[model samples]
Target: MKKNLFVFLLFSCFLTHSQTIRKYSNEFMNIGVDAAAMGMSNAAVANTNDVNACYWNPAGLIGLEDSQAALMHASYFANIAQYDYVAFAKPIDDESAWGMSLIRFGVDDILNTTQLIDANGTIDYNRISKFSTADYGMTFSYARKLKLPGFQYGVNTKVIRRIIGNFASSWGFGFDVGFQFEKNDWHFGLMLRDITTTYNVWNINEDEFNSIKGAVAGQNQDLPQSTEITLPKAQLGLSKKFEFHNETSLLASGNLNMQFSKTNDIFATDVVSIDPALGFEYGYTDLVFLRAGVGNFQTVTQIDNSKKIGFQPNIGLGFKYRGIQVDYALTDLGNQSAALYSNIFSLKVDLSIFR
Candidate 1:
C-alpha cells in the first residue's frame, strides 16, 4: 500500500502542474484533414482546389469545377484513437464559394478505473465502467475572388468542442483567414489559424471532481482554472505545376509554418520558430498520382547524449475517375518521427454525379 500511495502522490503532482490552460490547447484540430494533404506532409495549402480546401485553404475552393463532398477516416496509435472528417463545398456564380467541414478525433472504450475501489475497500470487477474522450471541430467557410486577377481570399468561423466523459467539457470559437495569389505562373498561399486566439471555457463536474480530489495531498486542493487559450499560428506556401509530354505533369509545393515561441524546430529564434516542408506530386493523364514529402525537422537527443537532426518522410497515392477521387497516405512511416505511423485515406465525390 505504501508503494501505491507513493505512485499516486507523483501522479498528483504531475496533474497539478497541468491543471490550467496552456499551449497546444485544441491541438486535435492540428492533426489535419484530407489524405492528399497529409500525404504531401500538409504542403497543399497553395494548390488545394476541392471540398477539402474548406479545411486547408478556403480560397482554393474557387477552383472547384463543381460542388464537391469529401470524407476521411484514420486510426492512430494502433487503433486506440480514431480521426474522422467530412466536408462540402459549392461554387457561386463562378465568382465565390461557400463550404462547411466537420472533424472528430476521439478515444473510445476506455475503462474508468477511478471507481474500481469502493468506500468499503471492496474491489469488484462489476464496478468498472467504460467512457470516451473526444474533440470535435465544425467550420463554416466563404471565399471570394478579388478584382485583381488570380487573387482570392477566404474566411472561416469555427467552433471547437471537447469532452472528457462527465469529468470536464469545453466550448470555443475562433476565426481564421486565408489568401491565395497567382502571378506569373506561381501560386502563393497564406493561412492564419486561430487568428483571434481561440479560447475554450471549461466546466468541471464537481461530482466527478469528488472522485479524485482526495488523490492529491490535501483536501484543500482547488479546481483547475476554467479557461484555456490556443495561440495563433500561420502557414505560408508556394507551388507550381509543370506539364511534360501529352499526359504527364508534376506539381511541386513547399510550406513554411510559423509559431510564436522558440522550440526544437530547425529554425528557431527568440521571437518565432519556423518549420519548413516540401511536397511533390507526379500525375499521369490527371487520373493517377504519386506523392512524396518531408517535414517536421527537430533536434533530438540520443540515448548516448548526442544531438542529431530528425525528420519525417511521407508518401501517398491517388486515383480519380468520373468525378470521384480516392487518396491514400502513410504518415510517419516506420516510426521515423515522433508520431505513430498511420494509414490515412480520403474520398471525394462530385455532387453533380447525382444529377
Candidate 2:
C-alpha cells in the first residue's frame, strides 16, 4: 500500500512539472500514424495489438498475450509519404515480455532546383538530385506487469536516423518510459518520451554549403560547420477512460507537448502548449467497432483574434477478422488558410502469430 502511494505521488509530480513547460518540436517525427488514425486521442494508451505501439507507448505491449506484428503506411501533404512500424512481441511467463520494432519514413520524388539567370530575371529549373528523403528508427522494448498493486510499467530504447538527399543526414538516440494503472472500469496512463535529449547531427555538403556561404560570403564566414537540432521537447501525457458498458466507452485524454525550441531560434526559450482530446468507441461483440475523436493544440496558442490555430476534427472505424484487425481514420485540418492543411488516411494490419 505504501509503495502504491509513492507511485501515485511520483505520477502527480510528473504532471505538475510537465505542466510548467510547454513547446512542440520536430513535430513531424513525433506524430504517431496509428494515433492519428484514432484522431490522435491515445492518452489511455490501449494499443496492445498493433506493432506501432512500440512508438505510441511501449508499456502497452504488456497487454499482448501472443506474438503479434503489424504495419502502417501514410501519405502526408506535398506528396511526402511514410511507411512505419513492424513489431513482434512474445510473452515470457505471465509477467514479462520483450519486443522489437522498426519504423521508417520515406519521402520520394522530390524535385531539386537550381537558380538560372537567362534574361527572364531568375528562373529555377530541375538540377541533378536524388529521389527521396527519409528517416528511420529501430526500437527495443520491454514491458512488465508490476507486482505493485494497480501499476504497470514499460520502457523502450530507440536509435533514430534522418537522411535528406545526399547532402545531409543525421543520427540520434532516445527512449520512452511509461506507466499505467487500471481498476474496475477506470483506466489511467502516463508516458515520457525522448528522454535522451536526442539531437540530429547534420552532415552538410558543398552545394548546400555554398548556398549559405554565398549569401553571407562578403562577411567573414566559417568555411564549413556542423550543427545539431534537438528533435522535440520531452513530453508527458495523461489519459483516462471510463467504460459504461461492455461494448461502450468514453475516453477523455490530454497531453502537454512542450517545445523547448522554436524554428526561428536555434536556442529559443521553452514554451508550453496544451492539447486536449475526446473520443468515443462502440464495440459489437468485439468484432466491429466505430470511433470518433476531436482534438486541438493551436486553440490555446494563437495570439491573433482573427487567426485560429487549431480547429480540427477526427473520425475513424475498425474491423476485426479472425485474429487480424484493420483500422482507418480521418483528421480535419481546418481550412486552406491554415497553409498545408492535411488529410491523413492510414491503414493498419494487426496479425497475431500465436494465441
Candidate 3:
C-alpha cells in the first residue's frame, strides 16, 4: 500500500492538464510577464525599444539606448497567485549588449488534505497540512549587430526549476534564439523559444513520500517518476511607427505565434495551433503612454454547425521621466470562476544616470 501511494504521488503532477489533450508541459512559462509587454498583448517581439526586450526578443537587447534595469510584479486571480520579474542590461560596445533576468511564478497557502484524519480516525482540521508551489527561471542573453546594417541577432540560455510543496522538484535547461530587423519606421522580429527542447527531470524525495504514505495508509498506489520535455515554438511580429508634429506618435503591432510540436491534440480544427495578437500604443515624446491589445483568439466548432470563440482584451498606461519609468496594466482572464482579471505593475530605471 505504501509503495502504491508513493507511485500515485509521483505521477500526480502530470494530471494537472487544462484540456483533454496534453501535448506540452510547463504551461506557466506561457503566462506573459512585464506590464509593458502584457499591456501590449505580448506582441512586443518587434517593438523592443525598451528594457523588456530581453524577454520579448533578445535581439532587441542591442536596441537599448543605455544601461537599464527593470522590475515587474503581478497578482493573478486576485492574489491567488503571483508573478515577478527583474532584469538588467548593459551595452558591451557599439554593436553588442548583454542582459540577465529572473522570473518567478507561484501559488501559496495550498492546503494539503492527504492527512485530514488523526490516528484515532477522528476528523481533525488541525492536522491538515499546507504547502506552496513555485516555478523559477534565470536567463542570460547576448545580442549583437549582424554584418548587414539594421539587422541584429541574439541568444538566451535559461535554467528552470519547479517545486511542489516539498514532495517533488524538477530542474531544466533550455535555449532561445531570435533576430530583429529595423529600417526607417518599419520593424520586424522572429523568435524561436526552447530551440533546444527544454527538458525537466523530476526528483521525488523518498522520505517525504514515505511520510505521506504513512498518513494515508491502505490508500497507496505504485507510481513512476520521469522527465518532461517542452517543445519549441515560433513567434513573428511586425510593427510600424507614425510620428506626429506635436511630439506625439502612434505605433501599431501584431504577432503570429505558432506551436509546431508533433501532437495529436486538435485545436481550432487542426493538430497545430496558430494564435494571433494585435496591439496599439500612443506615446507623447516618450513621456506618457497609452496602450490596448486583444489576444487569445480561439474558435471551437460544435457538431451542429455552431461555433464559440474565446477573446481576451487588455489595457495599460505608463509614464517615464529622467532615469525612471512606471507602468500599470489590467488583464482579462476570460470567465474564470476564481477571478476574472489580473493587475500588473512595472518600474524601470536607467543605471547610466549614476555612471
Residue runs of model 3 more than 4 Å from their true location after superposition: 1-14, 17-22, 123-126, 210-220, 261-271, 301-306, 333-340
Question: Which one is best on TM-score?
Answer: 1
Q: Write the per-residue lDDT of candidate 1 for residues 26-75, one digit (tens) a residue.
A: 87888888888888899988988889889989899899888999999999
Q: For model 3, state the Cα shift of residue 216 in Å.
A: 5.6
lDDT of 3 by residue, 1-355 (tens): 4334533643465344211334567777777767877777888888786567778889999878899999999877668888999999988998999899889988888777666666687777787677887899888999999999899999999899988888778888999999999888799999999998888877777677666666655644443345777888889999998999999999899988878843322243344567788988899999999998877666645689686666668789989898798999887645421225788999999988887
What C-alpha lDDT, on a 0 to 100 scale, does residue 302 get in candidate 2? 49
Candidate 1 accuracy as lDDT: 0.85
The models' CA-based lDDT, in order, is 0.85, 0.55, 0.79
TM-score each candidate.
0.93, 0.73, 0.87
Q: How far is candidate 2 from the true structure (C-alpha RMSD, Å)?
A: 11.9
TM-score of 3: 0.87
Q: Which regions of candidate 2 fall more than 4 Å away from where they truly are?
A: 1-25, 35-37, 44-50, 115-127, 211-225, 229-271, 300-309, 333-355
